[model samples]
Target chain A: MTSTLKTFMEEQLPIIESHMYEFVEDLTAPTSLKEAMLYSLKAGGKRVRPLFVIAVMEYLNNPTKAGYTVGAAVEMIHTYSLIHDDLPSMDNDDFRRGKPTNHKVFGEAAAILAGDALNTLPFGILARLEDVSAEQKVELIRLLSETAGAEGMVGGQVLDIEGEKRQLTLDELVRVHENKTGAILRFSIEAGAILAGATQEQRNLFVEYAYHIGLAFQIKDDILDIEGTTEELGKTAGKDVASEKSTYPALLTLDGAKEKLAEHATKAHACLEKIPSNSKYLADLTDYIINRNK
Target chain B: MTSTLKTFMEEQLPIIESHMYEFVEDLTAPTSLKEAMLYSLKAGGKRVRPLFVIAVMEYLNNPTKAGYTVGAAVEMIHTYSLIHDDLPSMDNDDFRRGKPTNHKVFGEAAAILAGDALNTLPFGILARLEDVSAEQKVELIRLLSETAGAEGMVGGQVLDIEGEKRQLTLDELVRVHENKTGAILRFSIEAGAILAGATQEQRNLFVEYAYHIGLAFQIKDDILDIEGTTEELGKTAGKDVASEKSTYPALLTLDGAKEKLAEHATKAHACLEKIPSNSKYLADLTDYIINRNK
Candidate 1:
């Protein structure tokens, strides 16, 4: 089953990767910066966010091209965030995805520039996607800006930074995790629905599914921090505990955290039930999020 | 004569400032990031880029609202660039517009994030503009991205940064300045025309006008580095000379630089001649660029 999941994931992964390469290539400028950006971009991640974007788009039966613009865009934003997040001022992690983080290779200033270059590359890619109605394009840009900006990912980062060495309520913890991890997840699903011309009702249900899965995803991450080895997770484990940062397992017992994960998984699958039975991608993604070990 | 120019500049500056503030409040995330963003935003600069955007819009008789979104957006992108440029690794300047640079106040990391926040916020604002057709909006986003990204401003920056402490030919110098300073200027004028619904012919002329003035603007800047005092220029004078970076004046004799400025100014005026004779603001802007002391 593990092998099968990896195989299935491997097949879908390159489609997003190819689109990301094309979009980044199209978006970056000045040969040196483009070369630098392309180097780190192709270095590798699970392509989780872009895959989420395309998978959601596929689930909605939208033509895949629309997702390319947003797919690459979200990846760039995520990559840029990672590049910046791992800088010396923040997490200061040296390795990401089994390679040196951007700052590690590029130095802080160039890494910052590379990240800045990557961040703006998305809007450039979004601008290039053709044949979508103007309304949909505008909607896509709006969704992206909101998710990537302060109210979403960056806001979560601030809280994450600020919340260090202090206790956080479950509600506050949820807010941070949701914005940090969930906003992009929600954006991925919603963009799929919007492009597929899914009814608002359908999109709302997808949002519901994303919300639950988003929470589950983070809880699993917290669980992995305690249970998984560094080699397996490809990042240092137990750092949250070491740093006294809040996590599901920090705020609750391991059993309680495990129970929360189960509850969110159940809610995610429940939200999936409200959608058409034909959305195998949605169903599989929900299961995949709860079941995946890495 | 100086008072006339000052009066004209002063009167229009506040209109742009108030419009920018109101739009940020409506669109930006309610977080400290936004507050930091507004601090640099309202802290003050010439607002020249947005003024160019709006002047073209007004010349075309477009609604002021249309200009607000792109106007604010161009400013955000411009400001973000300045914030990053002022970092310790880059220009390392402490003062801008006679106040501490964003990095100085916020520290490098937060300053970087603050810039990232502001950079993305422009699109958020642009996406919210009402009454624009979807097509126009997409085009506007694309244009702004093209101007701001590596192929344009960022690319120019790379050249400028790398070219320092080395000799560059006149062609290389022009190429750098065009990308660094010219593209955004072109974007400003063309953005206004695009928003205001100028015909291709009218836009073509404005494009020509912007191209000329953009070059003239840089030449004037180069001249100012030599001719103006630090107090009058409001920043350190001769930093370029000190840095060994090539400028128009660096490559050309002072007389040659002045002569080139006049030649570019004449070309800028000829581009304006294609518009109706009554377009005083457009004409006045060209004159302002050529004659300004600081």
Candidate 2:
């Protein structure tokens, strides 16, 4: 990782974690339900989504406490998706990030409720965001719902599941990745841009950067599934090929997948260049997405 | 049902159904996902939640098209909850309203996604409601996430599931119903009042009315589970008793439960009377809740 990106993560990771934990901790929910929700939230992931949100804010030099709150909201949504995606009926994974999945620890029923609770809680968090205009809150909620709802993440999930039963064309695979993984990643950057009050042109450029990195992020996952160890990835590796799930490497050869990743990385950096901001962290974060071990 | 409510339903039910169906139809999601979502929504239910929203608007004598939109939003949340509640890991019911449950029809993964999609789409619907101020939209979204989220329906669901393992005190039973069932019902009434520009005093009274009727709704449901045939109820009757679930009749006895239902009905009616408006439909709806066979 670049020193700039490393410094950013070192300074901001705890703030992100504490903000999320505090939000979940304050919910007047059942202790067990809260625990189930917290289990997945606390389960260590890269926090890449929140990093995108905050990085955009910092790049614009318009950082605010509300950025952290929005970051927490996006993280909760990301966490909830993981919990549900790990369900027995979905991916059926028992582990994530080297720990038992939410359903594994909380039982399926509580896990489902926990996912539901997490999904419902974020909008309330966004809606109640102080220091942001009501119009912005509405826009954020609207955008989040559009990107995260069936038309975006959930719809893409359905497409991905359906695609598993067939050999999808490259276009179909790109569509799935764009919706399933790309949508929320795009939301993270766009949310930061909205919160930072970026100009329309800057916001559009950030979205362009987000799109390339999103695909890069997923392609890296496919690559890591083959190359990275289970210990390093902190989850089961090589399961993708075993499941015969359509992945970038399954369609494109490994070298071709890596080439695609680098191509997107180059394009992402180019998009960042058009935006007039100190986006050194974002630039480094793009490299981090392409090269991350996990 | 009184002629007032009968007329209201005859006129408004189709409007509510079309509003909801159109919202789902307009979504740019996968066709199958949309079908899965539409299936449960089209499955026959009393539309009680939406009725509550519109009934409140009618009661205030300031109805608008936006009322139906908000009504659609609440109904979607209600529908999503029922879909998730009937999952195999949850209630494991094979049927609902005399038809196969969501998971049975769409597979568990799709059903879960459908429920998740439904859970999310409402806030966007509320956020984009025409004629509503941004502040009101934010308030609506905030209220919804609270009442329908961890602290309310989901938390109550956990309490209910835990209660099924053993007998619960009457207070615990009430708490379960208050959060599990009452919260969203309360949201319906409150949403209506908010949309209708009701005075705070009037809104508070409507909430009291909603609280009474909310419990009454559950008590009536519990009573129906015992007395109503599966043919009438369109679901597996007597399952609560078969599962040894804690319910109003189990705690209060059938006659005692009936008396309690009557007491709430009286209280609900009194609250309606306190609001100086044409609440004939609301009053009649309260009667319908207490007296309905299914």
Candidate 3:
């Protein structure tokens, strides 16, 4: 990535994090629940979701603080999903982002409630959005709920967990990844399109880009599990193999998985080419996704 | 309580249950998640919350099917709270409504996800309400989320869990109950008022009515835990006492708790009297709150 790209990320990342912190620092919650909500939220993240909201709004020439609201809400949902997924009964992961999981630090009950609180806060935040029309806010909420609910993230998590017991074919694996991980990521990408009132043609192109990147993101994570380290990945490496969960590298050779990643990246770029916006920045974000060590 | 009141509950309860079942029977959710959600939802609730929505809307002369939307949303929150609360990590209860808890039937991870799904369903449901304006819908969502989320039900659960090891004073216990139990009940009542665009004067009166009945409801629950049987209650009897959780009967004697229930029930009726709508039926419902054996 260019120095300009890095600078853009450096500038935007903290704004996303600052908005997240302000959102979490509420008075209604007990200190513990608030602490639990803020703990993982403030923990380092790529700020990819929030950035998508902002970038999409910017691309449409309607950059507004509403993007920040939508961005913070999505981030809260993403962080909550992670907290619940790491519970002892679920992934049993002791660490995430090189720090103890929410359940590890807070007790299981508090962790669960923290996840619950974070999940519910989004609706309240979206409902209270002053910048958006009520219709738009409701639409945003519908998109978000559909992405996060039973048929989306939770359903995908179920498939992923059940897949641990046996080898899943590429199709089954795709379904799991799409729901478990892809759904939210796609929402993150296309949410900007939805918020910015992109034309159907533009929205379709963004979705096309989102789909390729979503698959590429998961394939890269599977590759990273094999090739990356605990220090670099910020979590235990080789967990897929240890858990016997199916992965791109497990089904396809490491070379083949890397080839698939490259294919998706190329395809994602092709979609970006068709868009009218100065998607040069989006292309840079995609490159960052591709080149990130973590 | 009049036979007419029994007739009212009998007729309305099934409608509420049927609506709840229809809401849960979505085509999008995975079968297991849907089953887990439906399992608790169909476990034969008394439909108190839905009835509140319906009745309050009727009292405001704006009765509509949207009350079912609000009712279903709040019940989903209530049921989700129960699912999470009954987890082995939290209350560790084995049964609810005389059946195995969600975790026991669907496994802990599914239970957690099921709870999460149910929690998210409310927003989509409320956001889709056809009868209410977008502004009213947002207001309804805000009220429901506040009551169901951290400041309301989840916060109360945290307080209740924290108070498990210590004997709480009456004030602390009431605060816990008011949040944990009373908040949602209040929402159930005022959600209709908000939906119907109640004047501030009427809203305050409804709040007064809801507050008294909310306390009465909790005090009666404490009394039931002591006086009712496992079969009668459809839940393990004396759970609060066994867990050393404070209760009205524990702090106030059984007689004292009964007196308190009567006091709140009477106060609730007085508030109902000032309201214009033939709230005589609502008054009857308060009497039932005092007289209910289970």
Candidate 4:
């Protein structure tokens, strides 16, 4: 990671982690339910989504405490999706981030409720955000819902599941990734812009930047499933190919997938260039996305 | 049912149904996902929760189109909870409302996604509510996430699941029902009051009324499990007793449970009386909750 980006993560991640943990901890839920929700939140994953939110805010030099709250909310959403995706009925994974999946430890019922609770909590977090205006909260909630709901993450999941049963074309794969991963990435980036009060022009540019990075993020994931070790990736590796699930490498070949990733990386950089901010961290974060093994 | 409620249902039920169906239909989501969502939605419940929202508006004489939107949102939440509750790892029910459960029809993954989507769509609905102010939308979303999320329905669900392994004390059982079922019912009543511009005093009264009816609603459900036929209840009757689940009748005895239901009904009625509005429909709905066969 670039020193600039490393410094940013060093400063922000603890704050982000604490906000997420404290929020879940403070809920007046049953102890077991709270534990289940916390199990996955505490289960370490790269806080990439929240970082995107924070990075964008920092780039604009308009950081707010609400940004961290929003960051926490997005991370919660990501955590919930991971929990549900690992369910016996879904990916049926036994582990994630080097730890047993939520369902593995909490059992399927608790895991499902944990996922459900995590999903519901983010909007509440956004809704009760004190630093942002009511209108901004409304906008954030609306955007998050659109990107995360049926037409967004959930819908994309359905597509991905359906894709597993067939050989999807490149266009179809892109569509799947766009919704499954791109939607939330878009929210993370755009939300920062919204929270930072970015200009319409800057917001538009960030959306383009988000589009490229989202695909790059997923493409790197597919590439890592093949190229990285299970220990390094902190999860079962190469299971995508074992299951004959359609992935970038399956369709494009490894070299072609790398080329595609680089293509998006360049485009993402181009979008960032137009944003006219100290986007060094965001630019480095983009490099981090392409280079990261996990 | 009282003629007031009968007329109210006849007039408003169609509106509620259409609003919900159209909202899902118009979404730019996968067709199959939409179908899965709509299948359970169309499976037909009593529409009690949405009706509560609308009935509150009618009672306050400050009805708005947003009331129906909020009603539809609550119904979506109710529908989503039912879908998840009937999952294989959860209640494992084969049927609901005389039809196959969501997972039975759509497979486990799709049903889970459908429930997730439904859980998410409500906040978006409220966020984009045309007639309500941004502040109100924030309040509604905050209220929803609290009542329907970890500290509310999901927490209640965890308690209910744990309660299944052993007998729960009366207070524990009430806590279970309050979060699992009562939270959403509370949201329905309070959302209506918020949308109708009710005074704080009126809102407080509705909350108290919601509390009473919430317990009454669950108590009636337990009674129906014993007394109502599978055909009448549109689900497996007597399963609670069969599973030796700790329900009101299980702890309080059927007679004690009925008396408790009556007590809540009386309290609910008293709260409604304190609100100076045309509460005839609300009163009838309360009666319907206490005495309904399904």
lDDT of 4 by residue, A177-237 (tens): 9999999999999999999999999999999999999999999999999999999999888
Q: Please list the residue runs of candidate 3 whose C-alpha ends up more than 4 Å from where it truly belongs after superposition.
A: none
For candidate 1, lDDT tens digit of each residue in B1-294? 255546756877787788877766764354656666777897787788988987787677674677766777888888888998988878888998788988788777677777887777777677777888878888888887788877788788887877885899999988888888898889999989998889999999998888889999999998998889999988999887887778888789889999999998998888777777534666677788888888
Q: Evaluated with DockQ, which candidate comes out highest?
A: 4
lDDT of each: 0.79, 0.93, 0.85, 0.93
lDDT for residue A71 in candidate 4, whole number 0-100 = 93
Query: If you assessed candidate 4 against the hidden native complex, which CAPRI class would it receive?
Result: high
The worst-scoring run of ten residues by lDDT in candidate 1 chain A lies at: A1-10
- In candidate 1, what are the lDDT values of residues A1-294, reduced to their tens digit? 355446657877777778777765664456767766776788886676766776676676665676766777788888888888888877888998778887777667677777877777687677667777878888888888888877788767776776774899999899988888898888887887887788889888888988999999999989888888888888888888888778999889889999999999998888777775554665676777777777
User: Any runs in candidate 4 off by more than 4 Å, and if so which?
Assistant: none
B212: Cα error in model 4, Å = 0.6
Question: Any residue pairs clashing in model 4, and if so which?
Answer: none
TM-score of chain A of 2: 0.98
What's the TM-score of every candidate structure? 0.95, 0.99, 0.97, 0.99
| Poorest stretch of ten by lDDT in candidate 2 chain A | A275-284
Superior by lDDT: candidate 3 or candidate 4 = 4
Report the TM-score of chain B alone for all candidates: 0.94, 0.98, 0.96, 0.98
- Output per-candidate TM-scores for chain A, rounded to 2 decimals: 0.94, 0.98, 0.96, 0.98
How would you order the candidates by DockQ, starting with the best? 4, 2, 3, 1
lDDT value, residue A263 of candidate 4: 99
